[model samples]
Target: MEKIAITTDYITLGQFIKFIDVIPSGGMVKYILQEYTIYVNDVEESRRGKKLYPGDKILIKSIGEYRITKQ
Candidate 1:
């Protein structure tokens, strides 16, 4: 799994997606969420506003797995 280091206590799913360069802008979050199946700690997630903290595991179907960590 790839590790994503963040300076904040938490980050929104939409922001995370952008941080990972999955989308060009925040406005594309909705479209990407609708196009892919994302799982947060084994639970299916669709909310762009979903808060993700350190130690959280994210699985993006057909993309790759990622883990959140503190910088």
Candidate 2:
């Protein structure tokens, strides 16, 4: 699993955009939500603003996968 460290207790949707560097601007989060291109804790999450906490596994299709773990 690719470990992604959380620098804080919360991260907004806009911040998530940076983490995913591949998706084109303006349609990144939308694409993920609409296409079910992401998974949280092994389940697909369609909410663009889905708050991710520590110990969550996020799967981004085509780009890669991330396992969020607290420091």
Candidate 3:
């Protein structure tokens, strides 16, 4: 799995998606969330505002798996 390091306690799903370059802008987060099937810690997630903390695992079917880490 790819590792994504974050400096903060948590990052919103939308921000993470943008940070990974999955979408062009934050405004597209809603659209991308609807188009892609994303899982967080094994649970299917759809909320763009979902807070992801260090050690969280994310799986995006069309993309790849990722693990959050402290930066």
Candidate 4:
């Protein structure tokens, strides 16, 4: 598991994906999100606009887990 400290009220899934370097481009992000599953606090999530706040845990299938925290 890894921790990603964010200084904000919330971050969108797409932004978070980019912030974490999941995929190289925005187009890739869309494709990856469709192909893979990302879990938020143990529940599957697919919306790119899904809001993620501090303390939220995200698990990207076949990749890794990330815990969001306040910076």
| Pairs of residues at least 3 apart in sequence or in different chains that clash in candidate 3 | none
Q: What is the clash count for each candidate, in the order shown?
A: 0, 0, 0, 0
Over 1-71, each residue of candidate 3 has an lDDT whose tens digit, in order, gives 99999999999999999999988888999998999999999999999989999999999997999999999
TM-score of each: 0.97, 0.72, 0.97, 0.93
Error of 1 at 52 (Å): 0.2
Query: Candidate 4's C-alpha lDDT?
Result: 0.92
Candidate 2 segments whose C-alpha is farther than 4 A from its true place: 24-27
- Looking at model 1, the pairs that clash are none
Candidate 2, clashing residue pairs? none
Q: Provide the overall lDDT of each model, using Cα atoms, as 2-decimal numbers.
A: 0.96, 0.69, 0.95, 0.92
lDDT of 1 by residue, 1-71 (tens): 99999999999999999999988888999998999999999999999999999999999998889999999
| Candidate 4 segments exceeding 4 Å error | none
Q: Where is the poorest 10-residue window by lDDT in model 1?
A: 23-32
Candidate 4: residue 21 Cα off by (Å): 0.7
Question: How good is model 3 by TM-score?
Answer: 0.97
Better of 1 and 3 by lDDT: 1
Tell me each candidate's RMSD, in Å, in order.
0.5, 2.4, 0.5, 0.8
How far is 30's C-alpha from truth in model 2 (Å)?
Answer: 1.2
